[model samples]
Target: MDAHTVTRIGSHDKDLQELFCDYVPQVFRRADFRRWRAWGQWSDDYHAYALMEAGRVVANTSVMRMRLVLEGREVTGYQLGAVGCLPSHRGRGLARVAMNAALDACGDAPVLLFANPTVRQFYPRFGFQPQRQTLFTTTYDSVPEGPPALTLNLDDEEVRAGLVALSSEGLPSTERFGARGYATVASWPVANGFARPLRQLGSEAWVFAGVEGETLYLDDVFAREPFDLRAWIPRLIDRPIRAIRFGFTPERYWPGAVEAGEDTEADLFVRNLQLSPEAHRFPIMAHT
Candidate 1:
């Protein structure tokens, strides 16, 4: 630790922010941090704590300010992501140092993160308890008769502007444990092509979804007002999806016997807060 310098750079810090962005892709091959930063939606609330060896980043942890809806109440929290160290820097406790700095900055606020399966044992050392998340799933019979939802390309300035406007409304897709700021964290996935934005013709609602095989993963929805999602699901999808999985709780909008399953992608860990798996699941797009 003595040979390295610990620095925290916010989104507003251009030079240091660029340094962090340049270092991230080396660790996360799919991360387009440079493009996300240039998209102009990078919130100052997102901060990166990095261990710099001379002028290059050796290890890093990012803390993103999140507005979470917990059990129907809106609250503030911190989400940690982009947490890793270069291979040369491993086994030196640099990652631990960066995590400590990030947690310290959060103070008493609830902190959460989605960690890779390989590092499942590391977070508990810092009081982060492994938590379960509910994945709501349901089966559909057939594709309804209507125009398929249009996939809004993020590259278009008009589509980007529309998403920003919808997100500024600041509505949580679900009242039971979801995210408030839609475009804040969601833009990363859209910009990186990890997820696509879709909308039905003559509708104001927009959906962020991912597809695999015959299943559609409905990550999040941005609409000015609440509507019956169960009915809208058919119109929202283009191809015939045999199953639909929701990232957020669906009890409010879609009130049917949707199977509640466990998340298999990444493990969720949190500190200073109790997030119940059966009660609510964090919005998928809100993940950093």
Candidate 2:
């Protein structure tokens, strides 16, 4: 076998699709190529590295640009996700090569990611430290009281579009849409194989829910006035749901004024290549 050649590439090209198909089976049990394409479409902060053997892609990883706001200030950082290597290429340091290239390209920005529990120890080798632990919160009885007067449809394209638009406004940091600035939250379900659910409350606001089995995952729950848990809680009450799991920030709104426990901390980590005086001054979540 010839030595693998690793190269940095743009996410907007066909090579990305080839990389996805080559390693989808090893990366996700249920990979949605359409959603992945959507992700690339909405992502503004994407840096991808591919490992090729004999001109065929065998491993891939990406560092998406993200924005984080803290103390009324915005900062630029990188969120590491979509890291994978083909099974045939594993244990050959292909991941390390791809990651090093990514880090080199990142310059001085702080890097962060939610590592799978299995690979927790692996990231530390690259100087990633565990900064926080997150939680998945759900409520069966928290639904607001109503007679189901409002129509609930999870498959409406308009609803999804609304949710996507709201995400950019409400949660700017996590929004991944438009060009190479950030990836829009709207593309999650289509990319991740999760079903999107829409809840409309008289045009006041809309919430998009992604369902995986009995668990309903809320991705970019957009609503004005802090969202009334009572109104939407009832939406899931009668359903055969085991629970509702929200990503990252659940404390923002979940009915009954539930506080996001300390367990839900965003684990901040860093991998420095060329640290500068202003590197530490850059807001951690600005570009996340």
Compare the candidates by TM-score and give the number of the best one: 1
Global fold similarity of model 1 (TM-score): 0.91
Q: Which clashing pairs does model 1 show?
A: none
CA-lDDT, candidates in order: 0.78, 0.53
TM-scores, all models, native as reference:
0.91, 0.69
lDDT of 1 by residue, 1-288 (tens): 454567988767888887887788888888868777777766787889999886878899899988777877878999999999988779999999998999999999999999889999999999999888777888765565566667787666677777777766746778877767657688888778777565643457788775667787787888877766666666666667788788777766565637566886888899998765565667788888
